[model samples]
Target: MAVINNDSSVFQRIPNELANSIFDFLPNRDIKNLRLICRYLDRHVPLRFNRVFISANPLDVKVFLAIANHDTFRKQVKELIWDATLQSPRSCGNDSDDDYGSDEDSSDDNDYQGQSRFQRGCREAIEDAESRLVDKADGNEQQSLLDNLMTSGRALSYYERLVEEQADVLETRADEEAV
Candidate 1:
């Protein structure tokens, strides 16, 4: 027999086994919020985001390092996996016939449609940035505009460097060293 009190914490009202099981189903974000919400939940709920992945994307390694360095999560981490999937533009496409998919058309309408979100966003960002700069400059030299474009990822050369840095981090086992 169990006693239920209206004023008690939801966890306190439930059986310990049930409460523990609920933690397993909670989403990572919810778990984080729960931990921050109360010390009781923090001590009771085991770390569920135990597996961390590092990929060519800089964000992946950054997140992995953040979790690996976490005081509580560091002790509970079970696995560190490397995601070898390279971040290439248009990574997916309609491959009904397969055969390496379609090549660029002269019109480029289909090509634009086939581009990944990352590709489109990067292009749009550069265009938007250039437009804004031009508006502010009131006809500054074109060379300065070109330099701004160059620094703004320079057609993804900056992204390539980030990928190279990620590889270096993995090769150096920086994530492992963080714990």
Candidate 2:
């Protein structure tokens, strides 16, 4: 025997407007998670993520291409913005130490001229901290500060690689090709 239902399921019964309103209030992450949880919700709440960002980063361009190529996501893209700013050739200020830091040593130029402004600042700060440590810190505090500064320096190096990659991308007009 076949059973006939007079009433439809709650999801099929819900209005699109109400679903849109609910989705509008939810964050992007939440919307994605919600869709994954319930197929009914996924089908009912069509993604309204209309805006996207593109930058010098390779992953950024790759993702943009993926979206543009996609049948559904392509329709949602409303804007394609280019991030022009690139972190190229860090300036080691030779003009005045006052601009970089007030430390007395900064006033006297030396081999440290090769260091970036931020690197100089970190070095000055660490030196100042070491002096304050007095007898309490022999090499222990200095080593800790050195470790932290080294980590920061490593991060800066990674960023520099990205900057170089961005410059290459623009030179080859890879962005135009992707489009």
**Cα lDDT, all candidates:** 0.61, 0.66
lDDT of 1 by residue, 1-179 (tens): 23333335577678988887887788888887877766667667766667878765556767877786778877777887877765443335552333323324324221233434444565566557667775555556663654545332344567767767766766787645544
Question: Each candidate's root-mean-square deviation in Å?
Answer: 14.0, 11.4
Q: After superposition, how far is residue 151 of candidate 1 from its true place, in Å?
A: 9.8
Predicted candidate 2 versus true structure: per-residue lDDT over 117-151, tens digit per residue: 65665566766875766667456866565544544
Runs with alpha carbons beyond 4 Å of true place in candidate 2: 1-21, 24-29, 36-46, 91-115, 120-150
TM-score of candidate 1 on Cα atoms, chains taken together: 0.40
Candidate number of the best lDDT: 2
Off by over 4 Å in 1: 1-8, 56-80, 86-121, 125-164, 170-179
